[model samples]
Target: MLRGIVEQEGISKEKLEARQAQIQEEASKRFFESASQKASSLETMTLKSPALKSRRRVLDDYDSIALERILGTSDLFPISYLQIGLNAGQSICRIQIRDARGRSLGYGTGFLVADNILMTNNHVLDSLETALDSIAEFNYQDDENFMPCPTHTFRLDPEQFFITDKDLDFTLVAVKDNPSSEKQPTDFGHLQLIPTAGKILEGEYVSIIQHPKGGPKSVTVRENKVSSIFDDFIHYLTDTEPGSSGSPVFNDQWVVVALHHSGVPDPNKKNAWVGNEGIRISAISTYISENYVSYSATEQRILTKVFPNLKPGPSSSSQADGYDKSFLGSNYIVELPKLSEEMENDVSRMEDNNYVLDYTHFSIVMCRSRCLAYFTAVNIDGNQAVNIKRSGDSWKFDPRIPESVQYGNDLYAKNDLDRGHLVRRLDPVWGDKAQQANDDTFVFTNSSPQHKNLNQKIWLDLENYIMQNAINHNLKVTVFTGPVFRSDDMVYRGKFRIPAEFWKVAVMVRDDGKISATAYLQTQKNMIDNLEFAYGEYKTYQVPVTSIEDITGLDFGNLYLHDPIKDRETIGHVIVAPEHIKL
Candidate 1:
């Protein structure tokens, strides 16, 4: 009976222990299954979290090789805000395209590349003729009160010197200076054009300041990365709107890298995109280098200053289109040098179909850009010297140029300067058109800003001395007078340049059939600051014909060798009075 009880007890204990072990195993398995499900849910949430992943992964489908490579470069060299001070608020101008009826066509943006030159898109400016009719408004921004700021408006130059390229879709034009003020494009500053290749790389930051959708100036900066670079175009994410057509696309350094043109879809399929395409600036530089000859030397100098790497354009003489030398008459002692290369469309034609050059005794060899030379027929014998003149005879603008371009009375107001005529009123006052020629002498283009002293004292004496010779010789003489227009002349009021020197070339037919030439040069530098005509302050030199030709860029037709001063060591003599002058 005792042995049976012990065996039963052992078997019961073993059964209890086995049951507990099985329960523990079942609990352990349930706990693990519950934990695994929670862990799986957490993993799913983390995989979808943007903050926890790499930026590359966040961009997801934008991982194409081009974008990937670009992003990689951007990733390595982080975009930085470098400059905001240099040329920040001075370069931009608001443009309005109008029709012949003064009707609004559209609005766009433009910036200065050189002094007096504004650049925009051809699509914005259609044709060269359209640009001349358009207006450029500067300081077109709102003040703190949300009121439109006071703006300066200027019309385009009548020179109508336009160079456009459809491939680049660019229009470069010359804007007129402020007619009433001494303000110039240089006062506003300009963007430095960089033509060196590889200066702009893909994945660099580009910040654009523009007048978007024809609205006030706005700037776009965030996420504005250069996505890709084609041969001539750059695709960026710079967020530009419609009216931003010609706004300069600036890099982080504020240097213009391209011109904002068109935009495309974003790579992420985010349904968020804008016009972000630009014609690379390098391409524009190429066009400029080829077409620079059409511009004036002053214009070219500005371009060269802005772009040191620029090459010279093809060589061409001054072009004066749609006009001939007949205005001066072929009966002269010799024909004036033909403006074969630098010919510009005649200002009369450029102005209107009804506008006539209507030249009388004097003619203008108008350089399409600069009216470089003026010629007048002088009849010493068959002429009446009309003294019909008034101190109040207003300086009228040349109808040939738009109001914005004419060098009118604004430059002389309150300044002791005189509007000296290239073709003196007396010289051309002999024929039936005496009054007309006298009236024409007042045209701003025909006159330069002369020091009152020099114009009254020295310059007048020289003209009188020459006219006196007309009586000694025949009534026939031809005179050509103008400024020696240098690219870097001293600026007045920041816009007009008072030429330091004036030159005159007078031709006469001697008693013998031989042609005699005399060249005169007068400088007014010492008298510039003096309001009075101080004696001994002016120097009038009877320079060699070679010197005159050298300074005026005029070919005198073998007259340099025939000058009285041709063989002198000193090309000229300083003449204070008529007696001091050598005819």
Candidate 2:
């Protein structure tokens, strides 16, 4: 149960205004104090001998010149400026979010900083599931003479990649490549991330081209300036509106410096706006650098561009990446199911892996026995694009996980068992990096041994049916799957141990915010016991989701109450067919 809101003493409007004014005054005083010190030093130097004073003035001029070089000159609209805006426009995108009926829900903005990767505010796109129906329109602007601009549209790729941080108010996603056309290419002429801090200075002129109120793109070329820089935020005097939530805040060189999120009221009594608050690009780079794993050379190169200092190896934990369980709608952590004390013994929870794979829709926890807990998502996109084709990437042990803990190919040799995907190969294949996701499913940690019939027939169909039919349940579904380890498991030629039964618990978030879940168990008892060279007979059952909690000792986080068979007395006995699913 949620606790009531904490009540604090409220201050009068006058007191609130006074406190805000004081804060502004203090900040202004600090800036001026430094300026005053510089002025005093210059005055003191001027009082010296003429030659020495002139020498001091020369040094000051040199300092000004150096500052100009770093911040870029405001003296003239240089040729570089035109190229900057042009390239930025190609990268900038207008985000339009809509509801189920195709009516407009709202709009925001975003920009591509690297290949197929776009950055925006978390509030704009809380998750790829929500972003599925949201359209990302590129080059949605007016021409030089205010003529209609050519544009391209790309869908959000939830299956490929998605990561977001709420404290930073930023979301990074990989969008589909644009098709071949006269309008645009797959690549958006992107801006390289600022390599480090001090790239954007306070009071420096910053540019922002955005679709305000979902209108055509408008640029704040001459009107915007960086007001302040905080640990995670950059306050800038950029003109924005309701539809500009995720617009990129760029420096004069067209380098993306921040993501404009919300406007703040001025402290003065004029009742005017001061500046907008934005999540710093550095914060974004740091988060993505630490949390998300790159799949291919292209993604690796882009990751290097966005996070130049990122090391080659994987991070220790998402917590090491400044993880907050509450952020991203508590997407990071997979809560252990509510189980009795007897269920807690001997269960080891694992999350860290070589993939840096704790993302919006999925995370993997491999046990010491080589099998894993795979948490994956199914949403509206998953329902449509469930047909993502597979590639022939060779299965390999993930370097980040202990090599000894994985079931390698040696286990399948000279046996009736088949190497199966615990997370299901088709489940993660959605979005821009669909190929990469397909490749990821081939990792050894995600594989288990299954009877050929179980892999090809009942088990496969059970998952396929749920993913397809659960479309009615809002498509924002999360699933957990793994093999159930028992002491009497089959020993494969003394090299590997294969379990007879495997379990899957699928939790779907209904349109009304309630969870709907179904637990399934598949066993190959008949096939493995026969010891004959024939196809195995497999049985798949729909068990109560709570039953898994007792056996796995992991919590499913409010998903138990949602089990369709939770209240049924015949649970674990009543079998469900694809057409007869309770969904």
Candidate 3:
């Protein structure tokens, strides 16, 4: 295959030979430099060591023993190394490359690079059509008792994301979501490809996890020595077969170093292999970053997940002065809702008498008495929205407010309660400041304690529907969300009050230039009990904007006039599906 690629590219034999020699020399220089650094460090350590004042034994073998102590004879690894390697091997899968008719074309190896994203050789999955037709079979190996393990198959979703480079011989595509599968793709954790160098040094051993000859998953453990290094490729003396094309070449720490693609044939002999070559992970990352502009927002978002280092961090100049009223445009101005005099007295305010707390793309007005946001407002630009993956739940307290007032992890630590985001994490995530906007949503000020069942089901679905609506129409939307605080709300943990009902109001300008405001209400009143969530049916409703204002004692200016359901006699319409949504 290497010869075939060389011939197809019309590369002269002389050029290949010269390139090989240059890479070999570079590898040798790197190895020597590394060795010199190690020796220098050892010498410094010896000079700093305390002198042995009382040496009782002075034997002939003492000098050799001391030398051995300074310079280690063998490489040592921890007992956990095997366990880590085994865990990493689970991500490896056999790729069954087939045609549209389900006829087998061939087979190769691939692995999860991110959640629902697989990485393989470009030659194995050359085009979008090829990837779409292929399927990834996980757990395609024998069990501990040498019995065949049940495999989980997942189809590739090239329509969602697909990128490849013929020169790099690498392809990255998304795997279709398989919620009903016995094992999820996320169950076998991904091998994050770090863009930085120094993962492995020259002359170090690399392990290849592969499915050789279209067979069960196998690993050649630390047997391949890196022989040469180039700008975009590395040569290793690794034993691999035809079906090992897309195997992940890993270092001792189970970090992926390269993507094994083809073998380097022995020049002196025919039908013999000298070493295997892999595309450097760093090179692939660089290529993707450089060509990021060509991809769609969805693809770019996925790329950012696969290469998090490429995602831009929050800018130092990013100053948020609360949600913008004119974010929808000059013609359509949606001012902040006015707080009633009685509600205003209980609202948390700064020294300047400003109640709105500024974040990246959102603002919050906390209720001083309830210790929860009276309302949170966010500006959503659907076109520029970046889908930043949630790293973890790290709810924090806003430093501007007293920590004693805001609820932390205590309320949701042991119960079925969820710290639901008032301003959804993905709402304000757009433009160059997406990551910062995402981080800003994690503050405790923006969260409300709700039943897990309510937060994860209809409420989440409604949020997705709203976002998708904005995206589909290529419009900007301003959203206001908060709990419907009532005097009779259930009290939990002796001090904190858990609101049973949550409401969201979204305002957007239609393509026809008319402003549209819609309100939604979800209740968990029956679900929340004394200290736990009892089984109960949770319902979401499309309500009139006037109803929200009446319940919360807040004036939303002229938003009620633009309500899609305001003219209707119904106060609340049950939203069972996406079609049930008014706007």
Whole-model lDDT per candidate: 0.60, 0.61, 0.77
lDDT of 3 at 79: 65
> Which has the greatest lDDT?
3
TM-scores of all predicted structures:
0.41, 0.47, 0.47
Candidate 2 has an lDDT of: 0.61
- Highest TM-score against the true fold, candidate: 3
Expressed as tens digits, the lDDT of each residue in 1-583 for candidate 1 is 0000111221222442343344334423433344334321112333334422332332325334423333343443222232352255467887887766676656788998877778777666646556766888877788779998777888886353455665676777778888675566668888778775554555456778788867887777645556566566776676776677788887544668788765553335554453357788878787666544434433455556657778644322112121233322464345564332333343323334432233445555443333333333233332344544543354444434454545667777886788787777677665454544555555565677788887888789888877766645434667777777667666677676667788888776666555667888888777664444433466888888789777766676776765777888986787777887655
lDDT of 2 by residue, 1-583 (tens): 0011112243233432343354345434433334334322212332344433332331224234433433344355556568758776878888887544555667788888666777777667665555666778988888879897877888777556566665676776777765654544246676667634445655566778888988888888847666566666666676777678888887655667787877665556464665677777766666555533434323444566656665434432223311123321454333534433443332234344243234223455555543443332322234434465554435655545556767787777776677787777766555554544555566666678787778888778877776665444326445668777677776766656667788887755555656567888887767776434745456778888878766656567766676878888875853446764564
Off by over 4 Å in 3: 1-318, 530-533
Candidates sorted by lDDT, best first: 3, 2, 1
C-alpha RMSD between model 2 and the true structure? 14.3
**Over 4 Å off, model 2:** 1-77, 177-187, 222-224, 267-271, 293-309, 312-583
Candidate 3 TM-score, C-alpha based:
0.47
For model 1, what is the alpha-carbon lDDT of residue 84?
A: 52
